[model samples]
Target: MVKDECKTLLDALNKVSACYRHLVICVGGTSDSQNLREELKKTRQKAQVLASANKNKLTTILKDKTISKDDRAEFERLWVLFSTCMEILEIDMRRALDLGQEFPLNVPTKHLIQTGMIGRTSAVAARAISVQNMKYEEGNDIDTIDLNELEQDISEVGEMIFEMEMKVNVLQWTVEAKQEPGTELKSTVSAGASSLGMISVHGDGNKKLCDTNKVFAGAMFSAVLIFAIVLAVCIVKFA
Candidate 1:
């Protein structure tokens, strides 16, 4: 019985070993993010089921009256390692899940101009108004903000915000007992994360994102004001 139980425990350990190795490869290699994520999830689930089965088998072995103390102790030691491995896999799987949910969408949205943060937001806002004026150069003052690697860093921050949003949603559901899906809920989460992600990127440039936010709002209002003036002129000329 002891020999049989030991074999079962060893088999479960081997499965866990294979899963962890695959996870590492997926994370660092150039594979589809969604596919890799699914694989990791399956691996974690399989490890958990195997771990439970091994635990039950060990319990049976320990229950046998003829089993010696040394053999029972060996089985118990294997169980501890099995339990620990399962726990570690669970933690990693959770991190991946938290990243994928909450419609946070990392909405990194579009490329942002760099001039908005520290020195001026108006210049970039004006240039953006005209497609012909929008230009980028590596060393130019009007260069685009954030490199691909930097974008990845912002994505990591977005994931953190996603986690925060999930906790807040759970708390809100508990308190209000309201899980109704509203159209705006999805947009709100996406916009909030997008705005926050922008702030993070801008902040890295020694500038406050709020400064840019105010400038943007001001630009929109200005455009409206100018359009209103033009409409008034047209009305007066016709009148």
Candidate 2:
């Protein structure tokens, strides 16, 4: 029975190894490799720390007299699995960093900016605005306005900087959107409509101005027409 249990444990370990091998093959040369390597490195570092803290834990478990041989085999198999996973994870981390260095913008930076703690103009501006508003509220005199308020003003200036940054981002998005078929068509149509609207508004304003000028010129035109008519009537009455 002990032999059979050991065989079963070995079989399970073999299956685990096969599954891991397949996963490695399937994940080959993919972005996950770098990520996995980093994760493995971290995991190994953590494992080392844990092992140092509890140096006797493995020996204690192995020395348990009540633990069946099969149970021991199972535990060993699990350890192997853990070790393999950690190694793979480390390899992935290295790969990821290399890829990042080679293709810097392969990963989108927007998410990082959105979630980042510092260096964003929007965030800086917001902080500045808050500080300035606080100082203004605290009754700081004009010449002696609080430093805090000045800091806030600096932060508020970040708003314009942030806006310019956003415009650049939007321009990039627009260019990319134009490359897409449907989006390109939509943008073209929208632009046409906007241009037409602008023209219509300009034309309407010009027409109104032209009409006013014509009204002012109307008296001169009418006087000339009436004079001609009166001269013809006088000639007809005399003849």
Candidate 3:
């Protein structure tokens, strides 16, 4: 009976290994990006199904008081393999997605240049207007700002904001997983170690995740508000 569960997990890991090989082919530029993302979506769904169906049963086997020590050790060994393979699958998916990369798009060079020019021009105009309103003299200026440098800074901040948002989403999932009893092992299988998997199945972890998400929300809101204000000012000035 214990061997049966181990076999199930091993089969799941084998499927993931096959999926990972296909993912590598997609990531190697032989396949289009859309196909790559689609494959990942499908893989995630399969993982969710596999975990949902088997996770509780596997846990039951391990936590049974009458389970033999040898069986327990074998199950643990297979569990580790399954967990590590799932983690690797998730990492490769994220890499293919370029989770924190700028733009995450394949826009044409011409369009990108045109957009950058317009934004840079509008930003400079907005800055000039603000400086003028502040009554800064030509000879004794308060500060000089470079539009290119400012744009780069804003882009970096935006990327950081996006990364924070992703982490917050993972934290929320972890908290919810803790709140549900049967979902603990399933969540670990589906979300990998960096997300719902590594989180403790404890109420304290749930509370801590919630608190951290709240703090992240407040900080993210402030940053997004500031960016929105700047963007609005540029739009108004340009218009």
Candidate 4:
């Protein structure tokens, strides 16, 4: 909800500013700039109001004596994140206005990429993964980093991996369903070593290469998918 307030307000201002820029420069006129300026002012006011409400909510969450330690920690973390984002948004707004910089229509990441308080993908920055100074760690007396979400994610993934491996083994066994219980799944081994099989397979080197390529591709895909999912969870949790 806090992220929505910050991002939606910034996005509105950005879009309107971009349109105003295009109209005044690309279309060679300032006809739309006046209305866009008014809209920007209104959006700024709305954003400020929402920001105040967000802070009040955070303050209430923090001061509630009945709240558990865990919940309080979460709320405190949220306050830090929200405050950092607002700080960046305000500073960036000032910078833009001072320089008369035209904002692009494309919305920035909801995770507040500008403040560098949250990690981001390689596409947005030079690093593949940038560790954020979460919970106002850079300025706070306490710097205890929380890894609970990461651990929970790993546990869930471990369960999924076990299930997937069991399914694979089941598939291997099902392939020989009609064979005797003690029979080995050696059909391919026997076939490849037989004289008839040798004759048919002697000239099919490309097929083996293609099969190897597919296995390599599948492994790469699985590795990337796991990495991406884990990275996303980290971003979401710390944001």
Candidate that scores best on TM-score: 3
Write one digit per residue (lDDT tens) for candidate 2, span 1-239. Answer: 54354444444434433333332332223322333222222332333333222223333444566888666655444334333443443343344334334433234543222222222122222221232322122232222222233234334434433433343222222222213567648978999999999999999999999999999799889999999999999999999
TM-score, one value per model: 0.36, 0.23, 0.38, 0.32
Q: When superposed on Cα atoms, how far off is each prediction in RMSD?
A: 26.4, 26.2, 30.5, 30.2
Per-residue C-alpha lDDT of model 4 across residues 1-239, encoded as one tens digit per residue:
64455445444434433332322231111221223333333333444445555555555555568977656555554554554445544543454353223332222334222332222221221121122411122332211111232233334434433443443222222232234654585676676579667776865876888899999999999999999999999999999
Off by over 4 Å in 1: 17-32, 102-239
Question: Candidate 2 clash total?
Answer: 14
Instruction: Name the lDDT value of residue 54 in candidate 2.
Output: 25
Better of 3 and 4 by TM-score: 3
User: Candidate 3: where are CA atoms >4 Å away?
Assistant: 28-30, 99-239
For residues 1-239, could you state the per-residue lDDT of candidate 3 as single tens digits? Answer: 65785687568645754564454333323232333333444454454445434444555665676878667665555544555455555555455344313222253333222221211121222221232332223343111222233244334434433443443222222222213565669766666755544555665788998999999999999999999999999999999
Each model's lDDT: 0.48, 0.41, 0.47, 0.42
> Order of candidates by lDDT, top first?
1, 3, 4, 2
- Global CA lDDT of candidate 4, please? 0.42
Query: Who is ahead in TM-score, 2 or 4?
Result: 4
- Distance (Å) between predicted and true CA of 200, model 4? 23
Question: What C-alpha lDDT, on a 0 to 100 scale, does residue 107 get in candidate 2?
Answer: 46
Displacement of the residue 176 alpha carbon in candidate 3, Å: 34
